[model samples]
Target chain A: MSRLFVAMGLVLLVGASLSIGVADLWAADIDAGLVMAVSRVPRTVAAVLAGAGLALAGVVVQLSVQNRLVEPSLTGTPEAAMLGLLGITLFAPGSALLVKMGVAAAAALVGTTGFFVLATRVPQRDPILLPLVGLIYGGILGAATLWLAWATDLVQYLGTWTSGEFSGVLRGRYEVLWLIAGLAGLLWLVADRITLLSLGESHARSLGLDYRATRLLGLVIVSLVVAAVVVTVGTLPFVGLVVPNIVSRLRGDNLRTNLPFIAGLGGALILAADVLGRVVRYPYEIPAGTVFSVFGAAAFLWLLNAPRRPAHG
Target chain B: MTFETCNLSITRDGVPVLEGIDLSLPPGGITAIIGPNGAGKSTLLHAMAGLLSPHAGAVRLNGRDLSGIQPGERARSLALLTQDQGVTARLTVADLIAFGRWPHHQGRPGHEDRAAVADAIETFDLGPLAARTLDALSGGQRQRAFVAMAYAQTTPWILLDEPLSALDPRYAHDIMRRLHDLSRTGPDARSVVIVVHDLGVTARFADRVIGLKDGKLFGAGETGDLMTSDWLTRLYDTPMEVAEVGGRKIPFAA
Candidate 1:
């Protein structure tokens, strides 16, 4: 029943996303069909893909570390990707976009792996500590990225990448995000193994799961999603954390059952936020990252204070 | 088919936890591995279940070396319930039990998997609480659910590490009774090996006992013959006595 509401809400959000843009499709002088094909559709698809990818990445990180508070933003994934981009741009000025994304994905994997290692030492008794560490860790990486960008006089590029916005998305540029669709399919195929991962290593192995291999697979998927999103739409914080958490609360942690809802809700909410970003400024844009930050911050506080559910780990 | 550990020795951080230990377990009965704190009882149990790689020697199940066996095959042969397997997710009793059939079905659960889970739920009397998440259940109930999950694996061997810890006498006794019944000599009987801290419970339930002290095998024999006051006294390095009341041996510190 609730799923029907979600579906309807998603359809409405998609319609809104398609209809609203700066070009004013109804204007007689404008090439409405060309504008819709080139900008509106691609922008809408970018929002959906980036939001869904982040949400799935968040699930992977949270489950891998056995903590609920973690997301790609907190884990330094976006920062690491930005750092990698900066390095590649400095070394190879004319590198292709795909090559840049590949380097960024590798760096994100390393950064996330570092956090996973740090998570082991952090006590699991307190659910809040892991995310706090991740925040500091990401802050450090963000500082490093900023320092590199400043030294290289690439702060302008950094600004665009750090603040997620879909204004620049067009038919040709935003297509890299299509990779998230394939990754989501992969997540569905291994949904049960991922769920087993929520069970601690001992029990998971006892149930015949190759715990290390499965966790590595999850990490790789998370890195790829974060890189793809970072490359296409910049870093959108809290979409992954907030969406998966809401779905988990509503539907439980059965990833096989919750994947579609998580992905759909994430995509819809982010697209809705993007549409609001367009309408609120009226011919200007607030940047979906900025608009969603306002709402994501409030939701995050509510999630923290909301009477405690079962603490992961 | 027999389960045996041949010259099994485990070293963690260059310190031996179980050294040059060996014993073939008798089939079709409850065997309790008991020792004082840090006696490496749990370590031995984990090694036997193929969870740990021995620094020397091997654990063999049905004439196959456990180290050489694939994890899926190993899971089908034995189900291990380790202490403090954290409930990180809000998994319901039914969801957790269904995971036991993972080795057989991998991800796609068939009718046999469903039937096994149903059988396990019925066996553990968890039908009422099947829908409730693990955190919602009491300690005793949660422990029962975990045991049921291991049971649902339908393995020939079940290894448990200190399952009765923190439970009151009644819950502990109830769990032991269920295991004892399932472990009785029969075609379907499972071989049960548990790392136990309670001597009283061990005395009342365990058919055979393996005693470990300071990472060495202190003794291993039939419970009736080896659970004497003198044997336990030496094993624990404390004065101990066994009182037989109503045909049941009860061990206590003197």
Candidate 2:
């Protein structure tokens, strides 16, 4: 039932995304197929891919740390990726796109690992403290990244990539987003292991899981996902954090059962946001990141204040 | 077959928790490890289950060195349930129990794995609540679900740390009764070792007792010998008494 609704909604969102762009496909002067192939399709695909990637990344990080509030955006991942991109742009301005993404991913891994170290030190009595710590950590890294960009006179380049809009995505340019599809597939294979991670270290180890190795694997996947999203479409805040929480609340946290819904809802929600951004101002557009930020902040607050069901109930 | 620890000592950050403890447990009975708070009962149980490496000596399962076995193989040999199991609010009874079979199937559970899960569910009488999430259940129900998960592993030995710490008498007795039956029934009965806090429940259900005091082994013998008023009083460093009613010895503070 819910799956059917989600699928139908996805189809409708895709159609709206394809038709609502500035180029009126119905006009006789326009080559509808070419425009659809080159721009609209890539933009829609990028939105779905980035959204799904972020959501999956969020699930892994949440399970790995055994905390629901933290996500890649909170963990300095995007800031670190931006720093790597900045460094690469300064040293080898003409580096290939793949090389840039590789450097960004490596840097993201280091930044996320640093956050995990800090996370262990922070007392976990209050559920909200971890994300607060992560937020402050990410902010500091973001400040450093901004300072570097300003010093290097590449603030404009940083601004353009980091805003997370799909306006510039085209047929060949957005191909990197397909890596998410492969990563999603990999996640499916390891879905059960990731679920076991939520049992905490002792229980997971008792169940024969290599806790450290599995956590490292999850961290690597999160870093790659964050890097890919940041490299291709800047930062999509709250997609990772918001989508998984809503799905887990409605359903449950069994990753094997909930992975598809999380990925689908994430993709659908972001694509819907993109479509809304396109249609809201007609010929002009808002970045999906900006549009999602408005909705995501509202959702975050609701989730924060929402009364948790009584454990006895 | 017997489980033996030879000169086992565990130190956490250079502070010894269990020091040079040597004991051998005979197979196929409920062996209750009891002591005062921070007496390293849980640490001894963890060391036996291979969670903590001994600083001075070794733990042996039958004849093989416990730490020499691979983690997957060790899980198949024995199952351990810690007191603090962390967050399980999102998992259903069935889902949580099915994780017990992870050692056998890794990620790809087959027909036998499913059968084992079903067996555990039935054994623990959790059929109606199998689909219910952990948060919806009471404390006793959640504890049963975790024990069932450990049971689903189908190992020969099961070790639990404080399985009945916060439970009321009824729930505590209910769990103990089930564990008692599990440790004594059929040809494939499991050897159950538990770090228990309630001396009354331990006396009623445990066939044998291992007493620890100040991180040292104080006594090891049959429950009949170990659960006497004087023995327990000495072990816990407080006055205690035992009364016999209907062929059962019940311990209480004097």
Best of the candidates, lDDT = 1
What residue runs in model 1 are displaced by over 4 Å at the alpha carbon?
Answer: A307-313
**Which residue pairs in candidate 1 have backbone atoms (N, alpha carbon, C) closer than 3 angstroms, thus clashing?**
none
Where does candidate 2 stray beyond 4 Å?
none
Supply DockQ values for each candidate.
0.56, 0.62
lDDT of each residue in B1-254, candidate 1, tens digit only: 58998889999999999998988986788999998899999899889888889999999998889999999999999999989877667778899999899999998899999999999999999999999887677889989999999999999999998999878999999999999999985898999999899999998899999999999989998989999999999998999999989988899999
Instruction: Provide the TM-score for each candidate, comma-separated.
Output: 0.97, 0.97
Estimate, for each residue in A17-72, the C-alpha lDDT of model 2 and write its tens digit. Answer: 88888898999999999999999999999999998999999988988888888889
Error of 2 at B107 (Å): 1.9
Docking class of 2: medium
lDDT of 1 at A16: 92
